[model samples]
Target: MAGSRRGSRSSKKTADRKDKNSLLGRWLRRLIVAGVVVGLLGALALGTAVYFAERSLPSYSALMNSENGQTIVMRARDGTEIVSLGPSYGEWLYSDEIPQVMKDAMVSVEDRRFYSHIGVDPLGLLRAVWVAVRDDQRAEATSTITQQLARNIFLNSNRTMDRKLREAVLAMALEWKFSKDQILELYLNKVYFGGGAYGIDSASRKFFSHSARQLSTGEAAIIAGLVKAPSRYAPSADVNAAVARANVVLSQMRKYGALRADEAASVDVSAVKLKKESGGNSIRYFTDWALPQLDTLLADSDSREPIQVWTTIDIAKQKSATAAIKANAPKGAQGALVSLDRDGAVLAMVGGTDYVESNYNRAVSAVRQPGSAWKLFVYLAALEAGYTPDDRVVDEPTTIGNWSPHNSGGSYAGEIDVRSAFAYSKNTVAAQLGNDVGFGTVASMARRMGITTPISTYPSMVLGTSEVRVIDMARAFGEISAGGESVEPYGITKVETAKGRVLYRREPQRGHQLVPDYVAAGITDLLQTAVATGTGRAAQIGRPVAGKTGTTNSSKDGWFVGFSSGITTAVWMGRDDAKPVAGLYGGTAPARAFASYMRYAVKDRPVEQFDTDLQLPQWQLEPDDEYFYGDPNDYYFIDEQGNLVEPSGGADNGTKSPFPPERQEQSPADQPRRPSRDNETDDSAPSAASDDFLERAIGGSLENGSTRSNRPQQRSPSSESEMDTGRSWRSNPPEGIIERPD
Candidate 1:
């Protein structure tokens, strides 16, 4: 028993000594860790100081310099202002413009200790760090009003230690440079409230269409709410977000003793109406007229500088042009109107009937087949290829490659002069000419005149087979009207820095001559004749006018391209989905639009003929005695250059029926036109004796007032014994969905 007690005592002594050694080791380890931590903290502090000392100083002279940049102002030739643009249409104002509620709301939400903080708020930094460290989440509330102001005006929003140090440095500099009230004023004026509006005044006017001097508590609260996230809190834009933001601002105001709790609660959140209206509301014309040129001219620079866009666009011309489209286009239809000066300056472009409602910019963006409009290009090529206006060409069934083109009327005319062929918009004649001219030459000529597109030498190019934009067509027509000056259409005149430093200016130089002056004149003469008596007769105005009507196969596209001395206008109406409009014709729709536009575009502009020297091809002359004795309205059709000529008479036209021979042929170009299904002509006439009269008309070549072939066997309107001929019925879209596509 005595030995056992002694062993236990010895074990206890050994255990105590080991415990002491362990305590000593722990103390030494803790001392080493503490030293390392101290050293690291010292190193970090020194490095931070050195980094800031070596940093480059900020230069805010660009912001301080008050040389206002050039403002883009669109005007008419007479200096009538159409639109104006500024740096968001804003100039900073201080307490004078801000209301009491706005000031209170701003201070309440942004900074509770705005007046007491010295550029660096140690307490705020500590709170931010603590939140960031807790559960290792990012800190959210680290900035003060002064810090935010520094970043909003002079610094970019970035996350880096250097940026934070810069913010601290700038805030300190601002504190030393300005008083609290002055700082507040600058901050208030500088903070952004979107909608392209910078200052409170602009924002106020944009939202309410009124000045900031007048604001109610609810309006002020909503305006102040935008400070958190301007784009997100736009009232009319995000209704729920705006309400939430307003409530937060209102809550802050109450907490800051700027408002009573119950008073804030009593306010109607719905009363926060946005000062800025939504949508591409106004300035649609600016975008429409400027974007295309901008896409081409703004080679390297982003669209950030204020600019001066000196344009030939006349506001009155555009308004009148748009009015015409609306009055003529079917409801829900889309339309494009493009007008240019004789010098090739685009005078007016209404991309849509109303630019504000749609922003697709159809005038410049849409590329569609010109239908018969392509025929004019073909005619121009043929006329240039030694073909005379009175020269006869077979209008019978013809095949170019695999595609066989038919006249709007199913049956073909044997022969017709060049003038009468185009006046009647003969598709088969155009195809025949297109095959002879080589589509490549026509495409080249079109390119020189500013028709930028990939032109295939396909036979269809004769009938406007190539697809092109309305703007491009307008540019080409402008070239013809300009007598081949080769003008490049431009919109922006200059762009400058905010300090009035010139950044850019548009100077379009004349490139190449497209066509001889005389060639243009002769063509214009034929176009005038067409307008006066042919398909485009509906496009005539009280003044001298020239135009061409284009109705594509199946009436899928309709166009009326015309020109006056001061402006060349083109109107196109169609469905966006490529559907046909039943019973619609270029003469009926787009031509009417052209006439309506001319009613106003011709104001104060002189009627001038295109100065061309080339003589026209042999045209059937209506002798002075004959032309004078008959009604002036009987034969002449106005041309693009505002002239007139007589149409060609084939065997059919030789037989006078008051209407021209081709008048019975005009319709959709897909299939030959015939009597309506209900009144369709049969294999036989109303009587056998009538066949004798038909034989006389169909005796020899069509030019000799005869048909040598079985032409009438195809779709002769005189036939009788009826049977189903497998004709398909085509219809246009609903009225509202139709837009004029010429």
Candidate 2:
């Protein structure tokens, strides 16, 4: 009975244990099923959000449509293509036709995991997100090759969440629709590689002057590097920046195993050879000169398409001007020439002697002292200050503070008219006039005449001590030719599209009258004297010509600024370093250059005369007592026999004249003259001793033992010291006189 009871309790215990085990198993199954249900719900929610997000995105119909039309062409005034903007769209290249090396370089630099990624790089996107969170939200997006192609083809580059999402969606769509090679073809065909080139075909032609298939690895890397910011890395805009980006691409190419380390290291910027501009090297500088102005004009216009610039450059004239510099410019000396119309149209420019050797456009870039060429402004100021050309200013030695300017000829003219002073380019007179009218006034006048460079208030500024560019000086002289109108020098007359659509039609620049017409006439007349008869004689043409010659101190700079009715031109010649050109003078080389250029430039133009009817104040010639000739009686007269004959107005008539005397000193009606000084011995006539003393003082005495004062007149040591003290301010003249270049 006891064993049966123990077995039943054991059975009950086993059943309870089995029941607990089944309950636990059912709870575990239900928990697993609930967890699966929760996961499905979360996936469904996510899928629904993705579907809606994708539905709102833009369509990708144009994702692969990357065909561009005709290339933009820039024209000169005569409708010749000076420059061509945009690339020639060669036939669309298949992936296989492109150099495999090019493809490797492009892939290495732009998108490394191009083969493995679906469309969007999940790791890259996560990294980009982390970077964005850590940095600013607007950090550069980590776009894949496919994503870039989608964004470039189907959308504008507006960085927003919506755009990014649309870009990702379109990238996936692109990947689904096209093969990897096709996607790459689209990317290559669509990317912008600056200088107005779009896609690999155009970029290859534009930069390397070759087909895309022929691009070397280095060229490929350079072209691939331009896609980031084409304008910034443009070879034309900044070659060094472009080279730096290319090196980065090369480094990436090496890292990605696209190229061997040694191969990558061997590549450099020199490996890429950019195509020469279409207009030929002859007009290259003219195009460069007009580029900045073109940008400004375009900015002001409403056009968005590539433009054709109709410039004032006459190709023939440009050639002639350039040839003139090459033929006439001194060896090792830089030369610049600018020719413009009275309306300030830049007709022709030669910045340097040889553009092939150096592209430093000295015509527009170089700044040097105008030398006497700047005197025009000073005289203009004098005119404005009520001083006339006829007004006589003392040309004698005049000191202001410690600065005493001498004439370039090293001799002073006693008195001279302002016109003569300007013609001769007398430094003392100009400095005096600058002080008279105030240097500030001269600077103001220069500013009005288009000298935009800074002008100092020093007296030396009248001698063109202030540095000025060749173009500005040309424009300043142009103002005078333009009948007192302010100059706004221009190059382009029209800007149009390649298809003949007008973009910017240049209107005439109307300048306000800065100087009265009569005043301009007066200045023109004075400048005419400089060319006609004075220092600028070298610049004389058959007809009326007016200009100034300038040579700076030490012959560092030589300049000639001149004008006719149709054109005003400025020519400058100098060494790149401020070393003196031995024996160089403005009246020599620069004037010759100006004349040579003008002879060809104005051969067809009519000779026109300037209006010289400015009603100016009449000035009288003032006789100066200090500049008088010696006594007329003491002077000799030439007889008909060509013999020197003295007047008979001698003290002793008893000594008969060997040659016949005009009149005897002892006139029969005249009484004996009284002695003027107490040292005189007799009233009849001064003794020989007095005469000898007077002659010795008037004429230089012999350096013999016979002293004027029997012994050297002893002076107090203090007197000698005082004389020495007074001489302190009188410095020795420099080895080369600091004469104005004019």
Candidate 3:
């Protein structure tokens, strides 16, 4: 019985062992199937990522010939290079032409496994990932030379995983298309160094003032170190930082067997030389103004090659204009100047005192009220409407609608000739003329004269209360200088590629006549009278200059727009914020700046005369007119002896004027007579107005109608404030109007 029980228990134990074995076999099969599914999912995810990344890759040709930005070389009219815009590129060097040490240093510092990898280094990536996790930082994948070239040429600096995947795909594509040597050459040629340099050759010349072919070990080390942070490690920026980084590169070179210990030690970090930096020139303003035009001119061209632009700027005149502004612009105030030839080619432009301090181009961009300079358009309208210089105009206080306009000194010369009224800048005369001829006509005249800014139709607009650009003012004056022809200002003359393929060449165009020659002559006649014997006496520069002085209310803006010797120039002075300058006036600084610049500008040019046949009217004091001195108030009057005397009765109570009756009785022969139009060949001749007449007219004595001297001891309040009330009469003559002796 015991034997039979043992046999059955043995049979039951064998069956239990079979059941356990079967269960183990089924679980193993299920685990194997799950592993295959997981592997398929990971492969699908990687393939999907790569497909999206490839879609963003640039074409092969685009990748090979990529220029990150447009390159332009601007030259002056004389063919001298004024400035270069965008990245500066040097000659493309081949892999063989590049020094071996430069290549070695670059590879050792940037990517040690560059040559062995197929664009994306698996082992290096794994090592990088491990290091990142160990240090608790983001993984810096694509840490190879080909990967860097891919990012530099085809991608922006975005640290997202999507961009990283694209970078990796582009790197592999570049490796497949080109040989390793070609990829290395492209990487070196297209990498950006500091100072606008885009190639190793350019970086070498820019930083060391030498070529890449002559690079030494230390120089190569410095250049190689710049790839990490060009602006930070540029030798021109921080020499110590550059040398320290270069030393790290040198140590890597030694570790990679590129240099021996002694060879690396021989590199003298202190002996590194750098190119000297030049001072910032104002030519940048010219480039900034011309770049947009260049884009427009080359709009049809899709070529990415470097361009050579020939502009109309005269470098000598540009330098002179810059110097004049620097010398004449008042402290704490800004100034701008623009010069145009008869055909309206921009010769010289000074946007501010210094281009480095501010790049805001005031000449072409800033719009400010022109003040009395606006009178040019008003008077031009009058001349176009059949009014001659000898025509009559009343200079007394006048009202238009609710606004009343008064002269500068509140003094009125009743029923004066138009020439005298214009010369003295009579506001009432201008307003009456605007009202009579129509302000719309005046605005249209301004547009015909090349003023492109919006015009206001208010009566105050006749007095230059409207805003205009300095360039437009120059262009308007250029119209008169060009013999009544319309003028369009231009800078670029020819545009061509570096390979000499012509893209654009400006054709010589003659502007149509916008005004009658006779009208232009009449306007020039009034301008001549203004400069010769009127408030514009401050602009006399030993030549027959035709210009007007403008001062806004509160002395906010001062301007002088004039033309001489076939050149029209405009000068403006004011605060950028439109705040009042304490003693600033158009006649004081702007007129002087114009004279100073024109003296140099026209020194070599021949003298030109305005074509005018109108005769200036002889101004005479009436018998009932009283000559008041010291602010023209009722309290003071100039006696016959040129003495200030207080009248016994108030000026309103019909007090007999201090005895100036005999002064008016001088015969015509004794009075200074203006030269007749038939005999006046040179408008620069001595003024016909005598010193006594000037003393009475301007409340100041004069010597030769150029210098102020022996003025009355008492001064007018208007004169003391520099006549800031819109070119008012003053005791002292305007500053800086020196007439050269014959």
- Most accurate candidate by lDDT: 3
Candidate 1 lDDT tens digits, 1-742 = 8899999999999999889999999999999999999999976875565455334333434333332222455445555656665457455666666787878877888776777887667787788789889959987656777787778765666688888877877776666656787667666666677645666767778776777777677777777889778767876456777788888888989988999988898988786555444544223654545744654665676544555455566667766877888888866577888887766666677777654345556788788878777666776676666555545466677877799987665655465456666766777777777766677877776776678877777777777867889988777766666665576666555545556666567565756767766556656766765676567878888766767888887777888887776578888988778788776678888898888888788877777764434553333111210223344344433222212224432223343223222111111332222222112333322221122333443443334542232322222223333322211100121112112322
Give the TM-score comparing model 3 with the true structure, all chains together: 0.55
Q: Is 1 or 2 the stronger prediction by TM-score?
A: 2
Off by over 4 Å in 2: 1-85, 90-197, 205-209, 221-264, 268-281, 289-309, 354-362, 365-368, 394-414, 495-503, 552-556, 574-584, 617-741
How many clashes in each structure?
45, 9, 0
RMSD of each: 16.5, 18.6, 18.7
Q: What is the lDDT of candidate 2?
A: 0.73
TM-score per candidate, chains pooled? 0.53, 0.62, 0.55
lDDT of 2 by residue, 1-742 (tens): 9999999999999999999999999999999999999999977875565566446544433544444433545567687766765544655777889888878878988889899887889887788878888987855678899898877666767778999877877777667667798888878887777655777988888777788989887788888889888867766556788789999998998888998988988887765787765434556677778876765776655444666678888777788777766776676788888889888788888888766545668888888998899999998987766566655566768676677887787877655567777877888888888887788999999888888778898777888899999999999888888888888878888877768777678787778999877678888888998887678878877778889999888889989999975789998988999898886788888888787778888899988978777764322111110122556556433333223345543224333233322222232224332212112233333122222323333464535523342212222224777677433411222222232335
Q: Candidate 3, residue 199: CA error in Å?
A: 12
Q: Ten-residue segment with the worst summed lDDT in candidate 2?
A: 618-627
Task: Write one digit per residue (lDDT tens) for candidate 3, span 630-740.
Answer: 433344344433433454442344554454322233344444432122122323344323344546756664554454322112232336355473234222223322211
Candidate models: Cα lDDT each: 0.65, 0.73, 0.78
- Sorted on TM-score, best first, the list reads 2, 3, 1
Supply candidate 2's per-residue lDDT for 289: 82
